[model samples]
Target chain A: MPLIKGDQITEDPWVYADDEDELPSGDVVVHLERWEKDKDSLRSRNGKLGLILRSDQSPELVADDLAAFDLIALDFPAFKDGRAFSYARMLRERFAFEGEIRAVGDVHRDQLFFMHRCGFDAFEVENAAVLQDWLEAAREFTSVYQPALDAKQSVLRLRHHTKKAAE
Target chain B: MYRYDEFDRTIVDERVKQFRGQVARRVSGDLTEEQFRPLRLMNGLYLQLHAYMLRVAVPYGTLSSKQMRMLAHIARKYDKGYGHFTTRQNIQYNWPKLEEVPDLLADLATVEMHAIQTSGNCIRNVTSDQYAGVAAGEIEDPRVYCEIIRQWSTFHPEFSFLPRKFKIAVTASEDDRAAIRVHDIGIQLVKNAAGETGFRFFVGGGLGRTPVVGPEINSFVKKKDLLSYLEAILRVYNQLGRRDNLYKARIKILVRSVGTGEFAEMVDKEWQFIKDGKYDLPQDEIDRIKAYFAPPAYETLPATDATLKDKIEANADFAAWVKRNVAEHKVPGYGIVNISLKPIGGIPGDATAEQMEVVADLAEKYSFDEVRVTHEQNLVLPDVKKSDLFVVWEALSASDMGTSNLGTITDMISCPGLDYCNLANARSIPVAQRISERFADLSRQHDIGDLKVKISGCINACGHHHVGNIGILGVDKKGQEFYQITLGGSATEDASIGKILGPAFSYDEIVDAVEKVVDVYLEHRAPGEAFLGLVDRVGLDPFKEKLYAAH
Candidate 1:
């Protein structure tokens, strides 16, 4: 099933009609009403293990609360905020979370490589065709630097040390 | 003067090949500007306002006559027949196409030169006393340690990505000619109480929009622990420095935000783990590096140059050049010659391809073919046989490369500024040109001797304005460019940041204001006192009183 929109099944054993706006795909429905995204909801919620979080909320707090989740949806209210990049890296390197970190809004193909290097795995791009452009980011540079999210060397450190016999 | 062994030569050659590939890839669209930016910068290729500029490193500012001639030839052929020697002891060709850089690097490689780490957020070209081994001052040779640091820092795995670029300078003499205090990491080579050679470490010294004097982190760093202490500092900075804002990412900012005391503590903690680690310098390695800098054979001769003295006394121009450009050497009758890149009205660090070739040839003939780039953006032919000084000076004079404004007011450290740098607001070279013209009289320059004037186009102190005895910083109000003047800045052992006189001035008024500052110093100062010494005792009050008292 597509992670963006797949099904809406209630516990009443009834299948509801899907809305025009695709409902995010998940087996569990986490109703994180405004202020209720506390540690309890984070720790107790048990389903497809995908929970969406607001951008305004502290990703650091959410990262600490998160134990085992398959997907993290970090919302983007406006395009310019770069708090998410740090949050993603913090989750990936700091918290050692090995799950899909998705960037949901105000993102384009140009920010894909830097975004991915900062540890955003899958981009919730605007259109399906945008995915192709996002892939172009990987082709931009032949090497990586400083062991980013991708296991590679930084351009500055990309000196291919010619091998010599070890002492 | 470090000789390139087979390994070093191979490494430099391989570097050229890699940079060539990178250039080709960039031209073929395999690498975009963003992708190619770091690569080109690491190779010392910068695309400025007018065209591309290539900065060729002069390790410890040492070069030979053959190398100098090669530089001159390259300048005449590839560039605008001139090259600018930078404040960091390197020569820059102001115009070259991106495609031509590979061949340039290859040509330089033949002469044992490369521009590795001249830019980017890595440990930049290590600088030291331009008159390193030849200076009369006693202690140790600064280049030996500089070379050690070069080998250790080159492509160090953990330091490739830092918050910002780093610069390290060392000085061995009592006089701080290398401006060690103005570097990111400055080392003062000294022997300890027990007669053990070591270094005094200074961290966080830098000049930019925010000028700072580095603090002495360690009273003394054992010679063997130089690389480890540096690693500790870099580790602390890399992990903790602010990466969120580019402007505040420099180690200077980290040193500021963390508080030097706390930062020192952090570095101490890190040093505990790596203080005696793998990168320690051994006697063999030190000897190896020292072998590269071992002075050429010298022949003792008379100390007094009666003939040269007579010539200078007869010709006022030669006198002026000799008074400013000649430095004391340890050997009898030998002098270290500083080749002035700043001619009367020429661009400060610009050297022509032909001029480079000429310098190379001169190095081979007169000097030991080893040339050094001064931190003041001048070239030095260290270890010139005093007997051959007359001949070298004549050759230099014919080429107009013999301005002799070595420590004078006209030997300006100027940034590319608005003419080239993307970060600058006003043009620096034109102001520098006007000042040079104003001070063109050789007699007048001598009369007002031993002054350091530095100019920067913007707040980014690429010109190192904070250390200039007379400093000029250009700023923009609304959209128009205006220049500010400061006095009493010194970069020696008693380093202090320059103080602004008052309000900013029009471009035309700025030069006159500088003239006024000098005139004030000339009027009130006692005999034989240098500008910096005079500025120290009286403070900036006399100059400031006269300066701001203007309309």
Candidate 2:
């Protein structure tokens, strides 16, 4: 299967020590928006568990009824449509569910960093130029912000509070 | 009045470049009106009835003297020598060329201001009580939280494309001058069982075709969870809100349909994920943003000045103006001064270039270089010393900004209805002028005591007519300008939508219709009962009986 995620494109993707922790399929069959209508019915299907439903389909609803799935795809639909971004943020900050969140469909190359900050672990680009753009966009803006997921604690807040950093 | 750091400056500069490119693309043949519409709207540019209008965000309606001067400069250079202050703590330039907007945005950025998110379906300018930092009644200035929300919502990655435009108003006092009851998210600062500072949130309140006084969603939302809860509400709206019909797109429709309790449950379920995230009230960030709005170095002075008393007694007009327009300040020597943008029968909230210059000069001379624009369509000198009241009065009178009507029936909040707005069904300015002229007598208005007259041209309720004590909605009946009059509506602590009084009235007959109701109130009111109180006591039947009884 064609994949945009996992370091298999660049490095060893599956770090699992044993084979039982990994799937037997050589290629993962990804989920699409049409399957979102019958996601509950498809969760029990044989080969369908390889991919996850997109974030645009109410991330909260998906979290509440998270039928055991390995990967979830967060689709941007367009660069301006932001519900998917908020969806990723909720998944990381609120749900506390540790899993691979993949960015897919309509996801632009420039928004990869923000997608990562919101908690997407992997990305699906439209083209090869977009792949390079995604890597560059992810590294350009360096300063941390307040609304970001806790990749780093708020140093500004800590500095202002006690007037000294804790040892 | 937050200062712009390098980060703020960079973001705004980049945004200006983006908007300029978008404008070029639209003008050239690269983009169509349908495609370019949202992009232009995000930048606060609108294609109105006559021209392109640019709305500049005056965050929480506060401006420094330098910023006020920049606005005056923009008004003279780009617009028709005037600016219109809006209810949501922003200013609108009615006559701006589409090509010259980028330059205007660049100028505004110099004053630490920009038009970002002023018009789009994003979180609009977070509004608060105009008397936030200096009011006698406010507890721990509402501008503090307003600033916090501003920083958090600025280029917020998640909530940019909401279902409909969102407005959030905060008020510390139980007496809400911010009209918090009529916003999408109305947050009142309240004390919990432990007497700690927190928020009481009300959701789904708004003023449009469907007027809803927001229902209480949270009794005590901790201060730290403000951003998380707001995210949850927006998430709920973005996900479940109606995209099929434009009229039903507002969150109020969703709340009314699904019920506020269910909506709150949905938000709570979403909030469970983010409340513990990194977006909390880290004391440092709050202090950093709060330092910008902290009170200025004020000199200790007497509360009442003998010199001012002499000036007031010498000129009866000046005394009436001082008593009516100025409000008590939290500090002993200072006061909040209100300069009327409405002069007699002139358009409400319209300040010409000369008037803006005078206001800027007064700000520089009287209370330092700080200024504020009140939601009441008036300019506010928020830190004026009580001793300088007479001088302000003189300067305002000379520039025709010294109309001594604040909160009276004559100080109506009116939009540029059919005169300029493409959406208005009927003309509103003419009706406001007629009503102002009718009640030109100061003594009559003083007797009327604290009545709000809000007029909207169409059902979109841009003028906020639904909450006015005397609400006038203009409509076209067979192409004739007829106004539907409503009574007992208000935007205060006791807020309610006005009740329609029978059939509509002709343009000429509307003034008579209002006068007849006032006459009825004057006849039936007990001692000290205002128009609203009288309506509550005698009911709409009395007013309805008089409107069509003998006519």
Which candidate number maximizes lDDT?
2
- Segments in model 2 whose C-alpha atoms lie over 4 Å from true places: A1-56, A60-82, A94-146, A149-167
Task: Give a tens-digit lDDT track for model 2, residues A128-164.
Answer: 5345445655654443335466364333443453465
- Model 1: how many Å of interface RMSD? 9.0
B1-551: candidate 1 lDDT, tens digit per residue: 66665656766787777678778878999778877787788778888877888888877776776677767767776787777778888888888778888888888888888888888777888988887888887588888888877766665444654667889998998888888888888899888899998988888888887788888888888887877788778866765666667778778888888888988898888688656644455565677667777778888688887888788778777777677788888988888888898889988888776677767778777776777778888777877876677788889999888987788888899998898788898889999999999999877888898898999999888888888898899999888778888777888888989988778888878888888889999998898998877877898788877777757
lDDT of 2 by residue, B1-551 (tens): 57776666666776677677678878897668877787788878899998999999988888888888899999999998988888776899999998899899989888888998898878899888878878876667788898788766765656666767888999998788888889988999988879888899998888888998989999998888887788788878877777657788888999999998988898898788667765566666667777877888899888878888898889989888888999888888788898888787989888887888888888888876877887778888888988888888888999888888888888999988999999998999989999999999987887777889999999999899999988999999999989999888888788899988889999889999988988888899999888888888889998888889977
lDDT of 1 at B42: 73
- Per-prediction backbone clash count: 56, 1
Restricted to chain B, the TM-score per model reads 0.95, 0.98
CAPRI level of candidate 1: incorrect
lDDT minimum window of 10 residues, candidate 2 chain B? B277-286
